[model samples]
Target: EFRDMKTEEPEVAPSPEKDKFEIIGKSTSRIDGEKIVTGRAPYTHDIKLRGMLYGKILRSPHACAEVISMDISQVQSLPGVKAAIQLKKGRVTYAGEQVAAVAAVDEKTAEQALKLIKVEYKSLPFAVTEEKAMEEGAPQVRKRPNVQKFNEYTRGNIDKGFKEADFVLENTYKTAVEIHHPAETHGSVAKWEGERLTVWDSTQAIFGVRDGLARALKIPASRIKVIKHYMGGGFGSKLGINDYTVAAAMLAKQANKPVKIILSRRENSLCVGNRPSSLQTIKGGVKKDGTLTALYLKNYTSGGIGRGDYCSEPVVDLYKCPNVQVEEHSVFTNTGASRPTRAPGHVQGTFALEGFLEELANKINLDPLELRKKNYSTKNQGDKETPYSSKGLNKCYQLGAEKIGWKRRNKRPGEGNGKVRRGLGVASQIWWGVGRAGTQADVKLHPDGSVEAICGTQDIGCGTRTYMATITAETLGLRPKDVTVKIGNTEYPWCGGSGGSTTTPSVAPAIRDAALKAADYLKKMAAENLEVKADDIIIGNRKFSN
Candidate 1:
């Protein structure tokens, strides 16, 4: 008794012709360009509420310490102080860990209040770098082990593959830790009305913050409303809830008024997340004909007191090889935890893998691009024999080579005759860009012939609002100006947080479906009014007729 459950028709293949779209791919001005250029667009930093108090956090100055005593009596008794909280009174694993927080009438008063509070600490030995952390007898940042095996993958027999190889090469590569510094720093402004809480945040994920607040404050998710009309940037650091947001909500409740807490530049650097540093050693065996025989990778990375990024993806899947092995280790150190930066693991992994491949090609007397083409894979080696939905790497290589005049490169590496030497190099990258499902949207057709599209996804400054408007207008046979796009509010249809390049693909289809349903309804209505079949009705030029 099995029945097919798919209700929607298969999507039509996209046409490469730009003329197929009325608004897409055209040289149109940004919808919000005027407001942004005129300095009239409001951002989270511009939020202000009546009777609002400013909040500041007190952080540990030592890399590692044990809090012996903390006295906040003087801070609480400050003239302009409204609420104070002690965040930590026990072991502190890293510098900049929040020890306490204070809310006052003004920023100056809050700074003064922070200084008035007293604390005594016992310094402990700490390791700030991966080299020092992995050394024997090093101060342990975590209780279990300083260096722990994080992940590993193996396929086929490496011994057999290496035996058939004509050449083998190995080298170690290193990448430094990077910090995420958005134009506007991380912050939050929280206000409570009765039991309902409203928050204006500079973040990538609103529902993430909403759920985090619910768990932190022990309240229902429905009682919390997170809003971010405009944000400067997030990259990846702002994808999750921050402690400052929770502290602001608590401080507001204690003071019985709204509270605004924005991290200072220094605070943002020390406390917020960073891209984990990676040290990868890759070994490759290749035949004289440029076919890859075996690939092996050993990665050591650190995310401070947290986990490390997986930096072996490129070695495992970027090329075709029967024998592949990868092992990753995440070491703990006395520093800030890490968050996803741009491409996270794949960027660092590709750097090492591609460089190794190029060196291997040189040893085999073959062109680097030619070697890659010889080992081109149409299936994802990592996921068994699953064929790729689309494989365009070979075409990309051809186009890129033709555009760059690759033949004009120096005949030999570094064969220049000046103090400054020149050479041409190439690299490759692979990552997941598929969208997640379970997104939704709504379209409303007004009696006056105007249309509106609603969704809860944030724009994140990628012209998402413009995309919705364009899709809706194209579906309704109306001008983009005739459609109003509403987004960045939790009260609308639910949408997943903006990250992993998921927002556009996920929201566009939902908007298209909603618009299609609206169009169907309008056609049926027109058919009833004109005494004709629905299929005979036509919609164009802002009118529906038979």
Candidate 2:
């Protein structure tokens, strides 16, 4: 029998100074702290079941090649090799594209089987660099030239704005591609019980995997249930279902036994998503007094065999520039598709726009901080029509400057004589502070007066579980220890998968509001039992009293 968490008394002191006596903002230790520290967290690969097959994939070796022929006969004929598949006649568009896969009784056998499967390739001319592809005579990565999408945006008359400007500055900035190496490599353990499919995947969205499995296998959604109790990390790479997830499910169905497919570190790096490299140019005109007159930005980037766009997101809205023109272009390369990284496009934009602003400020003989302050807009300049929920950029700038002693910064570069250079650079930023849609939270107050907060969201080192506990405890007038947080289950209510730094602001309020509603119901019930109005009673000393 399971013990109810509510009945157990917490081993801590109780306080009742505030109207709502509970812990919210106080930095309570994470409930999963001990488990994580002790290496007791049950990750996806830790799962073990009866008679599970190991899966290994065969990959292409050429950057751009056509698979002319594949010989998997030796691999299939090998002992303990349960299944093997190859897509040879079809083009292997990328290096390390999964050509085939094998399931064997053991990892060693599965790996050996992969090597036995040989493939032939017809090499094709490849273009990796964006600049080379855009040249007059470069091999076409796709049917079109090295232009994925060339989009232009304008707010006002650019010629008029440039005419009004006393000065203009333009420069190009480049950023390199970054890989998403989640602590846990991408993998999935699929168990098929007759027609029913169950997948234990290392992923951010369980339902997304389920949907993919359902569609790929031509099975109903009800037949599939994907569970991801805990993930090492995804960084947006695991936001949707991946090819490996589908492969594992298919292998399990074919083998008539559970199959676990976990890629090696090398495989993860090759197949998993990565942030596309970017090259951006910003041209801004500014007045002598440090006011931005006009800004024009052009970005060139590659999504690597997929579509990508840079909306000039940071430049088009960051400052109070009236005349703005933004253009973006994304080209395809013979690499993996670009996945959304943290603050996608914004980080690149910040580096370019901020760096340019610093240069422009130097030209105008104005402090960078003061220049940004002069261009600060209480409203978002991107949409121009839509206002923000709240903007603390100006306040953050002032408070940060004062705390960091902005006045001490040397106005002239190369003035510092010390071995170590002391420099202060300030950049202004704003995030669209809204969470994803279709979120549901359930807060329950047991008869023994403990709280349980349930939601279908994962805590990827972001203190989401603890935040939910705080919200629940705050509403019920209870301490952190009195609340049990439950999450990362498809069985629970729906919630947007965590991304875009929207989890905290978006879901925290929903959890708090749900907890409050539950608490109000409980309060009314308790007051009726005590023969007093709900307003007459006060929450104190972890109990309802007069």
Candidate 3:
């Protein structure tokens, strides 16, 4: 019923011809599969510390408002309440913004403390929809215009290219905002030891949180240890330091006890980041011979207070067209700032671009796949001169077409009518998945013959620990279960966040490097003992031979 596909784009820097891997290319179970399925694995939500207090935050109900008067003195005097603080002093950006926080002996007491704290806010005009935000004389989301142009790119002449075209097509596509509801809601457990802080968070980035917490608390990075051994999920929501984590830390410091804060499902929906909605219009021109002549895209996306998704990368890079133009705008609205969703801009952009291309192909009585093949690009993105060293997209298209029986697809839209219907469509996207040069890992060989591979990379529900064990064990001539993989800690060698599809590429190389170095060291030690050269040593099956 299913087929396993293997493919890759060549590495930027290829290594020497390597030996056949015993464990890597074989069928292997996840190293921690048992522990996870048996409920023995510890996640941030499962973490509990001694003298732990529950933290609760009071949030603004108004989408746009300025805090007029706030008092936490009553909350501070509440019985069983350990600490209380005013989180926001002036204007609140969005409805779920933290206005105040308190830590109490229990969840009931914490909830009671939030009710005792009173705050007054002056509500302001606001817009929550893209159409409403883009209207003229709209209530300002920020100092800048509500509809602010963020990106513009042009390659070759747009007018000339359109003039030369035989046929043209134009259409608009829209995507709604998407939210991440992980099995375990966002939470943090903070414990203080004098000036040092230790926080277990449900996050995708350990080092990022550590550095962020260090800056927020105005303490050295070395004093904060952020750990995330396991997390339910965080498509992109947990990539940075969250306000709740900071609130937990502050509460713990004031209470002189550990603090834990786990958000409710409602809180998760209101305050946490989500994928920004995109409205894109794509216009394209193609020749009679199925050659793409020009492409243009205008997109408007919203990210509340911050903007990051451009929604034009696919338009500029996914196809081969000399005359390409793109204009992107961020329509600010009163909502939670958008975080990077899985593939972020590419998802919306590709949907629009691919659908547009399909329409262009239908207009010319040509197959969509043939049109794509006709304009296959070798240059890097839209560059006229530069070339990517590795690209296997065309091959993928062929493999996919053959496997899915492309000929079975309908010739026109809505070609069939039935209670159950299936449609076959093809879509392609250009992704930049590469390693971070700054990523680092550590391999430690203990005196008792135990091995450990450590990094600050969070698991992010992606079997990071399993692959880490596999790589280290394969390199050191051991089994995956034999190598203890320790990750998700700031104390380990620093690694970048697990976003942008960079975790595997960034981490695999770093851990392999560390393991390879350890292997080389072992070779030298064995050769020195045997009075032989290091190159003559052979390592396999946990044995050294000369």
Candidate 4:
């Protein structure tokens, strides 16, 4: 009737040219493509209940302030107002920190009610940049030191390594904060059925939201259900439960009706998370023969009131270096916190490391690609020199150079006739793409010969639903259309949130195993009907025959 499957490590497979599979490596159309393009798919913002109320949040105008008092009596008395609650009554650390919320019959009424609530605040000195926050005698963003050493790493002796080098270079680089403005902004629609709460949210993690709500609302996880059918994007901003989601649920419970809350663009820009800004100073020593002698980095970054990213990973892992030292400090500013953007630290780290490597190659009068080859790392230096299971970087570089016609690159770095100069450059990156443990999938076989694959993973426009169907159909020896994919509901078999590029690798294996079990069952049933052994039967054109 049902099968639950889990896969931990990836099974090694033969090369694509030698292996044969029906749908595993083929190009198949996305299953949800028609529904999405036709605008028939139901996003969280499209959900509307019979007695739904629109919720709006009121945010602080000052970067740092202490709320003296709040008067919401007039807002509560409004005709269409259903519920009003104060979110923050004490010190606000950021400009857009939520201070209050109101739910009313319509969006206009909710917006109007927010204006009626009066709040008094006392402003405090604030730092808006990392330089300002790190300045001596600067206003303290938190109780701790303004610039706290967040993380550090050291390897061999830097002094001895630098002494062996022929030349050294040091420079500073900076990266600005970036926002994840997903097409569907952060939002939630909450409905309460007695003591149980069901929420439809545009989020990457349903279980994360469930756990966050349980902790915040003092309720059991079983009492909450999170669902998301289709999400425009998250890019890491929607990984955790947001304050707006909690506000909607509380408002819906108080008003005894469903509540919908969607953040405006400005609110999202100010309060929602971003990729923290980083200021890195890197020093490197290289020999004339293109061998790296020493590398040192000091990074200062700010994530507003939250911890900043660790931007020293590439420096330690990307190349072979004996002496390396990295120190990272995080400063707090009065702005939005930083969340994991796509690749988090690696993207920013790669930019700084590669830029410096290019300049180092030029200084040594060597080809950049050849210089990188001189210090290629076969093992992960960061993880105690563990040999990689497989490394295709050399092949990738060779192929890339061939495809790009590397021989035709400019001999001089900035040689061009017009103001526009053309140059060819390359950089490499490494990241975590491993599947998460404890992910699950379920497969069901119906008497009508139709199959269904069920998992709790949401499709964040990454072809998850299509791939789920593809894996199930491939394992069961059936067309993809014969399988029905059910996902984005917490009631289904548990799958981890879609992030870190983990959804396909995590869910596909489980789905494949479940389908294999279902296929075995179907084979057993077909053998009995065909008067032959299960292994003797052949499946073709959706038919099981002997």
Candidate 5:
């Protein structure tokens, strides 16, 4: 069953019935553009403290192994070794699993100290592919014996729908493992002050990091504050504090000094998260007229020894059909854990679904665009069953087709070729993030007339700072330059992390409301000065007079 997580509804402000907008919807320069260009922005790695020491981890060499013994005696006597820890108990699950760590005055010393440590392991049989892991007697990756579990989803009568179909198509598709190699490798600088822990982390979700650190350290959430004003990237990898962050905290506590740890590029490759590879089997039927009859799909995916579902989502209702069946399953393998990428499962699903549908269209002698338009659902068939708040999908498809002259596309592949083959493909997709719950914004107008808008969300190169300033300036009858937007701090009010495609629909209205409220306050002040009703005085370009 499709379910949407609860999200906040943006408050709509009453129109002031005025126009001549100065900023809203117009392109504007980013507030942090100068800092970015000049390399003046302070990222987490830029933090340096007086007693800070660098940290490095010694990782396992084998893909799958049992840690039999760990010796850190040589590492302890290294030139600048301050602290070291051996893997206390658990089995080494994957290559690069930290067997030990060392803190030193410098990275060179840290590197030397790490090499001094010794670890002996008992290697275990392993399977890298999802299919291999599923074999009857294949080496078990997870403690669970089997590699697959069924998560069947159904709607309507599939057997009858298949019976009515004139043609049926079945195919399997595969995607490769993808990494979220954000430019900024995962790093954390932890400094303890009595009971409080301050962390400078490179992460997408600072608030989530704070909570994760607090929980991992057995400290109250209030005692942990994570600061990450400028992050290189996440795609989705940096959503929360990883074990490395926690390890930095633990090492700092043991060393009794500030500790900084950044995963080396090699370690980052194995430890950082990625989009898991998936195998999907699609069985679909269509009529001679290009109408869909039944759609059945099954998905199996591996997240590198980690467990999570990676299904062909939105499959339950991507297109309209009388009968549909979907089963999503996940299994563990000796690979990196999966994390959300740009569109997560939807991008992969669309690639397979759209590609298959194009083939189906060819077999049925129908235009691909026309074929998709025929199956558009009036309501969200995949989930809440709610009518769309608004749908421009048909218009989008039509406009795109017209602009691209899709009618001229080679109907058959290999029809036009010399050295380069020319084949045109069309794909349709939908993302359903209206917004998330609990976002607050505060707008204030300075005595000198400049306005400030504050929300706890990062820009992440999405132009959030510019858009917010524009929204505020437009509402207050001012220019974008007259407004300021502050963000990327947990100290500010709660706002969703800037990951999903919901930022505009989520934050824009709040900015407008805040600007309107600030204007109302100014109007009240102006009414007293102009000897007229508050509503009679209109706010305009740096002036509050009626």
Candidate 6:
């Protein structure tokens, strides 16, 4: 339901007054602050269901192996083990790939049951590094070639632009693989009532989990409810329906009781996700006056069995280069698949691009800040000739430069000959922020003068509840504390999972739209009560008057 937020909204002309938000800019304590600090907030890890059995997954010890034979007979007959089932068959691609799962009276029993299950495997030669994977005779991780060129983008003539440049620079920048796990490891609690299922999960996407469970359990999505009122943090680790969650659901059905599966910290690090390593080589051409003539990026990244990020967006869209080209390849390795880590490709791309630009500026004896200002374009060069509706990047650059005392910096890079030195640097990033289309939310105003703003978007330890309440309250001329924000349950109106910097933009406007509609209804009621025209009525200070 969160993904189906598509409603064609006509563009609204920009308004300066409408853009200035008083309530939004102010600082306020989080609405859930007290509950969290007091240890009363119920996260998925803290949930305890009646008759709930603890579950644990058995994983392959080998990085690359083919299953010769599987035996879970001993685990099933083990005392206190409620249910045991195999999750994977045939070839295991990564080291921590799920092989089987066991549910028992407690986590210890479940772990012991897993140890009793025996599986035979034929270990296969595998490469786990990007460099080794790209080698000529390295072991193949997949059917396809280890190094596969999956993406390419080009605009204008590459050769012509390079020839037009006064100076050209080429260098290779490498970024190592980065793995960051959330404070709360991936987990789920599943309970079954007749044919219906309810899941308490620590996930970024609730509807995504519901749909995934439907696909996995062979049940209708309508019969499944996924709830995540709070999360420690996602960092892009928890996005869709994880296998452990499905295992819990299946175990619950088999054991005729609730099942809870929480991943260990080791499992979280091994299977959840990581930011893939990148070996990016950039060849850039620039004119004497800091004009970017051409830009070319060739990147090879590895995410184990996962798709690597397209680490060329910064080169293609960041500047006003006439000729730009990108060649991105994924070098498959035998390790945990990569997931979106924060900005994913952008962080790595920006580091490489920004560093290259600084070096490029040094070559031309131009200030890097001035070089950025000189090439600022209101039109997006990467997209199909679309002009930006609004861009405040240049203002940000000016303010940041001024605040950092840019004039006091050394004229050359690492030029000062002193034991201790202070330096200033500047960089910029393009963030694509907007509400996901079709995101729906509801505002309920009870006869008792209470308000509730409901959406399916989960707050991943961010102050989503506070802001939702603030938006609704401000719209209805009430205090932020007066309105209650309810979210993290699929039972609420549809909203997509909270990630890609979309939660606030997507959920806030939807709630605001509903709040505005409620305000309209209130104004109509007040006008009829006072025998005045609806348009003449005004709303402020929690009152409607003519």
User: What is the C-alpha local distance difference test score of each model?
Assistant: 0.86, 0.78, 0.86, 0.88, 0.77, 0.86
lDDT of 6 by residue, 111-136 (tens): 99999988999999988888888889
Name the candidate, 2 or 3, with the larger TM-score value: 3
* TM-score result, candidate 2: 0.91
Residue 503, candidate 2: alpha-carbon lDDT: 76
Full ranking by lDDT:
4, 6, 3, 1, 2, 5
How close is each model in CA RMSD to the real structure? 3.3, 5.1, 5.1, 2.4, 4.1, 2.8
Give model 5's TM-score versus the native structure: 0.92
Candidate 2 error regions (>4 Å): 1-21, 87-89, 309-311, 416-420, 445-451, 535-542
- Least lDDT summed over 10 consecutive residues: which range in candidate 6? 1-10
Clashes of each: 0, 0, 0, 0, 2, 5
**Which of 2 and 4 is ahead in TM-score?**
4
* lDDT digits (tens) for residues 248-291 of candidate 1: 99999999899999999888888889888999998888999998
* lDDT tens per residue, model 2, 70-168: 888898789998878763466665676788888899999999998998888889887666776667777777767667556777888777888889899
Which sections of candidate 6 miss by over 4 Å?
1-22, 382-384, 418-421
The local distance difference test score of model 4 is: 0.88
| Deviating ranges (above 4 Å) for candidate 4 | 5-18, 382-384, 538-540
- Return the lDDT, model 5, position 218: 91
Name the best candidate (by lDDT). Answer: 4
Candidate number with greatest TM-score: 4
How many backbone overlaps does candidate 1 show? Answer: 0
